[model samples]
Target: MNNNFKMIAKTLFGFEEILAKELRNLGASNVVEGVRNVSFDGDTGFMYKANLCLRTAIKILKPIHSFYVRDEKDLYRKIYDMDWSAYLTADTTFAIDTTVNSENFTHSLYVSQKSKDAIVDKFRDTVGRRPDVDIKFPDVRLNIHIQKNQCNVALDTSGRSLHHRGYRTATNIAPINEVLAAGLLLLSGWDGQCDFLDPMCGSGTFLTEAAMIACKIPANINRKEFAFEKWDDFDEDLFDKIVESSLNKTREFRYKIGGYDKAPSAVRKAQDNISNANLSEYITVERENFFETEKYTEGQLHMVFNPPYGERLNIEMETFYSNIGDTLKQKYPGTDAWLITSNLEALKFVGLRPSRKIKVFNSHLESRLVKYVMYAGSKKAKYNKTIKE
Candidate 1:
């Protein structure tokens, strides 16, 4: 049996702690969290599981080598001296992505260039040929990190971001990232225990991700490929076994997962995406305006979504947010609602106090994931009273 080794899972800012928790729950050893990243110990099969199951992770990397370097010459020498044959061959295509935080190497592009040169040159010197570079779809994707005089090289196991999930073929203007959607759901302590809803369900990303989580479905079950499949030692049988094993672990989900959007077009797109994800049997999308709708499920419901944060402070933003609060308080009793937005002022208009406020990012915008709980048999959501026109 293979002994345990360390691997790093990179995530969005503010998700490291939750991702670390996920790793711990997945049976990772020596789990540690860092800024936008988490480090943990697992064997080869566990590495496969982490790649296939971790939703918050953008990429999973296995460190190949690390050492100190003074300049580009030293970088090339050390990299060229390593046994590249163990990972790649002259016939294979590869890509190098470099990140540098040192004054000595300000340009990451040059670092990638130099590192690629060393690898290719080493292959030519040793095997009388060179490997080809394939940036679009590489056989092996390598990562180079240089911080001052220290350097670390890692293999990218998940070629594309794990957020791809290979399910979302339809998208609207502001479709949320799958990883962010899943992370926010996990942050809300959502399990399969309760019903769920995404009121402003543009493209139905939140609903789909929530259903997948609730059912314990493998996060990447729909993903087309993983970088490990392209490696020299790619284990097809082992991967098939892992996939089967993971699929067998899926739990039954009895509760409903629902979504709504006022725009018929948005509802149509959400329905299409949900069908593409093959979750139509489990998720239902409709065209009802959230303000006019009430809780459909009789038991406790979990709500999470992204509402429009008016960029220009339009009156509709205020009305929309306020309507969100009013709907929750007036109609949806025994529910916990969580929404993320960058518009702090607009969020204030909602009026209901958020039980939790977590800092997160939607792409480049700084945002907060805020939650409001309407206890069972309690009053509906609270919002600021409006004056008549």
Candidate 2:
């Protein structure tokens, strides 16, 4: 029996490469990359591991079927023919999410409606009952993809976006996303060899993610639940073993991880969230404007943050960015500073050239993750050629 199957891990834009790397590191074979997604071969246990450990994945889906359909009717026929009993019972509720790029399908709702109709119609004919649809919390999540005439149906293994991480309870203005924070850390070549800082740490998202990476803690160790747990095939004992194994691999981190924010409320939120993540022992939060703070550590420091983007670059935002560059150039030496912002105009005000600029999206906003390296005893920063578009 071929227990190994193909799984697709969905990520935000610009994370495909890192997600691919993570999958490969997790012992996934036949790894392949697609737009905003990474596909690989893994067993059921590996699937469980991925849901528990992967930091950059927003969702992990197991593709159950793919077929060619010329019209909506063909879609209904194909779905109606699948053995739904193998995956769901008549009492199991489900929700369908459809993504379409076909000329014939202009309304995604219609596509979802048609698919739901087929699934429920099949159950009614076979079992004399139909499962209810619960959009908020479904027992199973159905995914539909249509590119031209091809359709791929998949089972969403991750219920909510993995960013839920079940940790962050506080948020400041423009706090960065968890998956994005982890992806940004990875993009900045962070490997936990040095101290880390998020000077403008709004809600301490970067701080918590950094600690998890530093200690090799599973990203979702704090997450409440996964969609896979709701599936009929869920194995409680296996999941417990996986959790225990991941926790056993956690290493002690000696490096300093600190966060700072100008606002008192922000500092409190950061502290609360850090405690929620159970990283209070390894991380610290303070209320200090970064402009007034100097390097507290004598060793090399790894800094990552999301400074305010000035609402797309008003004068105040430009000044904020300039102060950031000034503080890094004048006060902080032996630091590798990285940040992400959609405000390109304010970015130029940072003054220091970035060694790397990556194209990524923060929700719908197009953004870039830029890195500036400030050398010890040198006022200027080292950087790669500018990649701004």
Candidate 3:
């Protein structure tokens, strides 16, 4: 039986393409990319696989219905008309998440309230009982997206954001988001071919993500649960089979991946998190200042890290960035170093030219992922002309 249905995977800015490619590679049919999201067709088993394997997705939503809403009353009526019993029971707790971008619906809170009312009233009128709203940990979560007059009602299949990959209980002051870390690694063309390094590794997010990517491990192999597990029609045996199949596809990684942090606390935290992820055999973490240390590998090295962006960390941006450039140029040869920072003004102080600069957002702050290529031997001396953005 063909039980395929359309699903949407939400992602951060500049990751739509990578998410789309991930969807296609995961056997999604008719994959389509939208702004900050990707739509694809898959079955229930495929959905489980996607939530487990996709590294760049924030959430996977299975849209159940779509309609045009004239007003709040119309929206309520449409929502009330849905067969809520198919998804929720009187004993189940539910939550409604709303995103609005329409002239008619200016406030998402109001939309959520109206949708909740509709669902509650429907249950009350028919079954004489309704589910309670539990925002923190709901048995079922629904998403209502309003774009102009069109409304998309979806079930949140992967709850609590897919970035919570059941690892990293500890974090630094300004830890990078796991989804963003994975996406940045993918954008940098990291395929685990060469030795990998995260110089300013904080809580080892990049290191964990890099190891997973290198070994072809499912992104959420350690995740405890998915929202679909709470669904009425969730098939436990099928999900278990999917998990085993995904694990069977994992490949062995031959290259070494490690991290270095100047701060002893950060190094300890990184080690703890890496150990929690069970990637100790594939990654090494040490307390060492990145600026003072040179490349350890004789072959080409791929470095990715999120240094202190100067917002939460106290440091002179210009001097820090200048030292970064000097160390890369003087010591780290035959390496491709990629870093993301919100301080654009300080990026100019790096002195070396960036081969590529991509616009990305770290939470609310706008940032750039810049790549610098350090050549080997005398060829490094030839990189005199600095390319300006």
Candidate 4:
């Protein structure tokens, strides 16, 4: 029997297309991109694989039901009417996560409370007992999304956001999110084809994600657990087979991935996080000021990094950005350098026309991921020629 079902992979703001492509490449059917999300058809095994492999996905939600409600009373009535025993037992613990976009349901916390009461009341009436709510670490996590008058109820297959890849225990003051790092690398078109570098490599998130992508390794391979594992029907044998198969698909990467940070403490933390991901064999971290260093690798170089955005650090913004342009233009050649920063005004000091600029967000801060292409020889002539063309 075909066990195909719809699943939604939640992602960051600008990663809908990337997530859709990833889903298609992973053999998903009917892949469709939505705003900050991608929906596809997959089975149980595919669900496990998506959680394990999708780098751009924040959470994989299996939508169970959707309905239209007039108000909180209707919402509670509909929720209470559903057969909760199918997903929860009297002894199981569950949590409801609500996202509200409807005028009727103004407060998400209040909606969650109403839904939780419905489910709890249903269980108590039918099974003589009700499952307790565990907010932090629930066995089965449920998603409630209200858009206008419609409500979508989905089971959260991957808990706590897939960005919690379980390998980044040590981080600097403002470390990039793993999903954002991976999405930026994808957007920059870094396909593990050549040498890679993260010059500002704070905590080495980009380095680890780059190495994993190069080697075709699963994104959440190091994660301790997924929310689906706590489900009552979770098949250990099936999950084990999926894990082994995913591991078997990992290929050997011959290219070098390197990271550099000026601070010794940042270097140590990056190294430690890289080691935690068991990627020391493919990545190296060193302490070096990025502006003073020249390109050490030959041929095409792919660079992606997140520099300080002046939010948490006290630095001269204009000079720092100007130095970035100077270093890339004078020292690095035949390199495609990409950086994401929220400092738009500081970017003007760089003085290089970007080949591409994509709007993205670094957490709540609106940011831009800009790319600069440095020609191998006669930088001035090449840039002028391109501009003239």
- Candidate 3 has a TM-score of 0.96
TM-score of 2: 0.95
**Model 2 bad stretches (over 4 Å):** 312-315, 379-389
Per-residue lDDT tens digits for candidate 3, residues 66-112, read 99999999999999999998889889999999999999999999999
What TM-score, over all chains together, does every model reach? 0.93, 0.95, 0.96, 0.97
**Whole-model lDDT values for every prediction:** 0.90, 0.90, 0.94, 0.94
- Give the alpha carbon lDDT tens digit for every residue of 29-83 in model 1: 9999988899999988888899999989999999999999999899989998989
Q: What is the total number of backbone clashes in candidate 4? A: 0
Total backbone collisions for each predicted model: 3, 1, 0, 0
Encode model 4's per-residue lDDT on 1-389: one tens digit a residue. 99999999999999999999999999999999999899999999999999999999999999999999999999999999998888999898999999999888899999999999999999999989999999999999999999999999999999899999999999999999999999999999988999999999999999999999999999999999999999889999999999999999998988899999999999999988999999999999999999989999888999998988999988999889999999999999999999999999999999899999999999999999999998899877888989999
lDDT (Cα, 0-100) at 283 in candidate 4:
97
Top-lDDT structure, candidate number: 4
Ordered list by TM-score, greatest first = 4, 3, 2, 1
Best by TM-score: 4
Clashing pairs for model 3 are none
Error of 2 at 54 (Å): 0.4
lDDT value for candidate 2?
A: 0.90
> Across residues 36-66, which tens digit of lDDT does each residue of candidate 2 receive?
8999999988999999999999989999999
Which of the two, 1 or 3, has more lDDT?
3
